[model samples]
Target: MIVLLNLGFTITSTSQAADKIAIVDISSIFQQLPQRETVAKKLEDEFKKRATELQSMERDLKIKMQQLQLNGSNMEPDARISLEKSLIAQRDNLSTKAHAFEQDNRRRQTEERDKILNCIQEAVRIVATKKNYDIVINANAIAYANNAKDITNDVLKQVK
Candidate 1:
């Protein structure tokens, strides 16, 4: 009984030293969350749709170029000039469209990243409050941590 009492005291002292400051892996939970997967799928579909549209435009441009090549020898000079002008315009339009898509995709990706980060931050705050932790550190900021000190699962559950 005396040994058991002493052991309990030692355990309490060790645990007290760990109090009020916790470490959480926000990236791990963000990667594992179902909402993140949903957001990723939506982004992926948007990217794919843009890629498909660009491919169709490219195919059309190639076809038009081939047609121009096959018929160029017999065409009047005005017709040839007009065709070349139109092809140049088409190429420029395609380039502009591609640039716009890239910019929009990047913007959307940034917004999504911010959204996930905000959610993680909110969860960390709530978990820290509920668990009586004075400060919650992000795992990325720490070099090494005890697994026993990981509060990621609790934060994940609270966030979800």
Candidate 2:
């Protein structure tokens, strides 16, 4: 019985050892990727001019509001009313432009993120297949894993 038990335990341990598992820190991989920075720069360059224009428009609106507050009481009623209407129109236009800018920025960010994620996924697949990893899991989803099982650096090298 003792011999049988030892044989059984040995087989179980050997089988478990053969069931390979790998862990990867995908967020870290994304951050470490050179493509991430290149994408960020591209997005920034695409939107910088519009962002600057929006800021200038915001500043101009604030100044107009301040001017109206200071001089409304001294101005003729018709002029005050016209100036108020102008400010309202300017504010509305600025609001619309700002909202559009935010939406566009979000869309661009999503696009860049998707592109990076696709690259990471491809890298993971290549490494997993090449290394014969039975399973590869995101490090964030796992409670604990041995460093020996980590393939993040391998994936990062592929990404770079």
Candidate 3:
């Protein structure tokens, strides 16, 4: 009975040892995937539009402030003070709005990039399962690995 028990344990260990180990280069997959460029271009175009709008608003604000300054200097004290305050307030408000828009745009891009990475993760998991990988690692995590062991192409195919 002891010999049979030892034999069974050896067989189980051998089977487990036979399982495949693979490595994936996630950065490579992201770089190679078409979705990466599509998402990046969309983000760029959105930011470009916002920047153009901000530039136009800035030009308008400068013009309005210059006109206010010229007219305020010749006006009554209260009127001049009010105009000065309004110009300052408008400048501050626009600055704040532009800053907020930039922050929100960056956050949106980060969230989208993360979502794409999640999809890539899922694709890797599915392909690894189909290929019977017992252990999968990022290529960057290993110092020395053959190019053959890098499953970047496989992951990209699955993701795309």
User: Residues 1-160, candidate 1, lDDT per residue (tens digit)?
Assistant: 9999999999998778677678988889988888888888999997998889999999999999999999999999999999999999999999999999999999998899899889888988888888888767888898886743678998888778
Per-residue lDDT value at 108 in model 1: 92
By TM-score, the candidates rank as 2, 1, 3
TM-score for every candidate vs. truth?
0.74, 0.87, 0.69
Q: Could you say which candidate leads in lDDT?
A: 2
Model 1 CA deviation exceeding 4 Å by range: 1-18, 44-52, 69-77, 146-148
> lDDT value for candidate 2?
0.91
Q: Which pairs of residues have clashing backbones in candidate 3?
A: none
What are the runs in model 2 whose C-alpha is more than 4 Å off? 1-18, 146-148
Candidate 2's TM-score reads: 0.87
- Computed on alpha carbons, the lDDT of every model, listed in order, comes to 0.88, 0.91, 0.83
Error of 2 at 137 (Å): 0.4
For model 3, residues 51-134, the per-residue Cα lDDT tens digits are 888888899889988887678678899988887888788889789979988898989889988999999999889988888887
Which number leads on TM-score? 2
| Candidate 2 residue pairs in backbone clash | none
List runs of model 3 lying over 4 Å from the truth. 1-19, 44-51, 65-80, 146-148
Winner of 1 and 3 under TM-score: 1
